[model samples]
Target: MALLQIISAMAMAIAAPLFLGQPLFTLPVAAQAQWSRVHEIPGFGLGTWRSNGDQAAHAVEYALSLGYDHIDAAHIYRNEDETGKGIADANVDRRYIWVTSKLWNTDHQPDRVEPAIRQSLSDLGLDYLDLYLMHWPVAFVPGDGTELDRETSIVDTWRAMEDLVRANLTRFIGISNFSRRNLNVILDICDICPYAHEFELHPYLQQNDFVNFHKEVGIKVIAYSPLGNTNPIYNGRHGNLPPLLEDPFWKKLADVKGASVAQTVLAWGMRRGTVVIPKSVHENHIYQNMFSLEINFNVLEMYNISQQDKRARMNNPSESWGVELFADLDDHTSLDGNKGQEL
Candidate 1:
């Protein structure tokens, strides 16, 4: 996989100028500015997956003030406009902020990819995104985030994503909620491999195999709900789950380390070499999350955290999607139907 990524990158390096009419190493000033922050994305990020209204805007402002450089959002999150306001209100240079959003499932069609990104860009009031992801590998009903569209192809969708890079709408493009099956497919046909893969990951749902797979293939693994999605949305994935913050085992570890449970968990994730985004709207929580890098966990503690995994997946799709997305997710090796387009 590493060899393939090297080859893919070399091909892109050679082909970029030939196809896009510029030196491969040289992009416009705006693009080059955003590109500089991609390396620091692994430590932490502020997630706005279900944030709403003006509060969402203020929360973004608070996060930015606390020194958070990465903001994870999605078009389906329905708060790009709010987040955009927050980014602007913060008075930070736009280039210094690392913004990521997703392409909605409804926009899986070849012709609709670019349009979906444009709307997100317009809503965010930004000219370009640091990273843009296909929110999910499965297409869905046009208006819903999870109502599956069984007819669309993920491979085709990715081709459109490649077009996004050429168009300079997103500095980099990626996938979220994709299983290994789906990622392998994208790599197979991609002239430029995806920069990262986002998925629901935490101590309880430690997807070690899948997480390691992504890194092995040269894709950075970005974790959403890094502390577990304790907040409910739609039908609610976090409601009845065990409170990771209050878990006695985890708490003991945090107490020993003089770290909060949230910090301990985030530290564990960073130690594993994946970028973990733990969402928060509160000022204290956001600030404490910023200091997570100061927290550390030893090998035994990491083993204990690993032992907490129950394969509990919080972001499973519903029957409304009309596809067996949850049960059959790992059964294939590619999108089979997961084609996509521009950002």
Candidate 2:
């Protein structure tokens, strides 16, 4: 795909304004001064998709202390209660925080959507969510995360999501892990446009085409796993890839700027205009990741990092237990080649 070409061109164009003395290159002084100003909602946030209850709560507290006002969660994570408790502990006004949750793969059937949302709300101890998402394009049988029967199409699920928004159960509703094909299915049938789209995005697996397409359609792109399985010490499932923290290039930049590698990666995502949700249970890492908001990298540095793309995807449906059910996912070539194809 020519995704890289588009990314390269955009990077160069964005740099032009910076080189010409445009104010856009520099971080907004007002924003920097008010960094800790009452739950400010920037494009960076915490994603609780992979953590358990206690860990997620700790992460939330860490994020809150570090000036993050956005928290991404989902029914699949089974940690909404912890996330809610963490928010409550922060003593921040509910309205000040931007909370996002997702409908699971199994809850796509029209009949199952509302009940699922109600369950999530009950679990989260909230009346409404800031944003809700259809977790994936394919629908499964209710109650089973792995049962991919396709009982309900994405359009039908989207129709249900529209109803949720109309009913005020959620302020916004969007999709996750959906290809361009799946997104078109929703657009053709739904009256309301998606507010955002969440997917696995990192330097190695640079989903530039999808990001651009979402931007063109006015849908915000929320990037998950911005740090591509860097620390082998964290979990072995991540497989071995060049750790983001130790990458020679990033380390060189980090040393020059006196910033952490994690901060550098986070800044890269922010520079690209995608909301990054990096999950961590450790307090230090949480603070470290959140501090990325205060740092800004120049165009050349950002371009240098972008060139490190290896298309390494950490989360793949093909790895699930029901291998045959998701066999098509193994065809990485189709995914890599069919840029912007409808689901």
Candidate 3:
């Protein structure tokens, strides 16, 4: 049955390879072109990080129905099966929607890379992924929880990822949660520079310098946790900082624009040239988030938000991973003052 589905999907692709819909996918130019004008992923997408259980599928399906052209998933999320079911349940055509998944630390070994993506494809019920990212710069033993594997070379793992593009399993490749130091290493030697980099970015925790660096290198930024402190995983990690939605400045801005706080921040992320993936299970929030594209921030508003950068990083697992993440950025040792014993 899966084989038949693959054949049918291939036949469909051959018949309609030129996708010129809302979220466009430009055909790769020969060799070097792959490195240039890489992908046209949508500005807004639905995130499936803690979007687990039946709600995960429902959120994805509803988001797509509401005109979300992109969906982000990862193997570590452990909800790809539900995410796939949601995509299949949606009425929209697959060609119009962009799907992204990630490779977990445990699968960073060169030989394990291909099978890792294959497993993600199987769960997502797709013949190919629009983008696949390395979940983190860290690597771990296959079954060991948070046990670092210091021997695996990220260059070799990236080589395997580049091959996925050639094999037509994924259209583009990127990295997530990598600091400036980690990114520079890849930039120095990668055959195909990363097309995008996913990390935490919000009004309160904006890393302006790092964001600029990505722009200088031509890498698209995908902002996860765009709403700030909304993800349950960040329950106590914020250290007394008020929820971003309740910030007086942002609230005033949202009121002025006649938009919700969520909408305002999401628009800010897009206006600054980054992709924003805000997750939600409620139908109302999903509907509101999609229309964030319509919220235009004025020059002053943008400037004011920029001035609010607190450099308060929320999602750092350096201590647990035993490597200093975001080593060169603000709040590098925020989480438990973990200086990365291994590092």
Where does candidate 2 stray beyond 4 Å?
Answer: 1-41, 231-240, 319-343
lDDT of each: 0.75, 0.72, 0.82
lDDT of 2 at 276: 92
Give the per-residue Cα lDDT of candidate 1 at 137. Answer: 78
Measured by lDDT, the strongest candidate is: 3
Regions of model 3 farther than 4 Å from truth: 1-39, 334-343
Q: Which parts of model 1 have CA positions greater than 4 angstroms off?
A: 1-40, 141-147, 233-241, 326-343
Q: What TM-score does structure 1 among the candidates reach?
A: 0.83
lDDT of 3: 0.82
lDDT of 1 by residue, 52-98 (tens): 78878999987776557788889888898999999988865554568
TM-scores of all candidate predictions against the true structure:
0.83, 0.79, 0.87
Model 3: per-residue lDDT, tens digit, 163-218? 88888788889999888878888899888779999999998788988899989989
The superposed Cα distance between candidate 2 and the true structure at residue 311, in angstroms, equals 1.1
lDDT (tens digit, per residue) of candidate 2 on 184-295:
7788877987989888787777767678888888888888888877634335543555666777887888777778888888878888989998888888787667667767
**TM-score for predicted model 3 compared with the true structure:** 0.87
**How many angstroms is residue 239 displaced in model 2 relative to the true structure, after the best TM-score fit?**
5.2
Looking at model 2, report the run of 10 residues with the lowest lDDT sum.
Answer: 322-331
Please report, as a residue range, the 10-residue window in candidate 3 with the lowest summed lDDT. Answer: 29-38
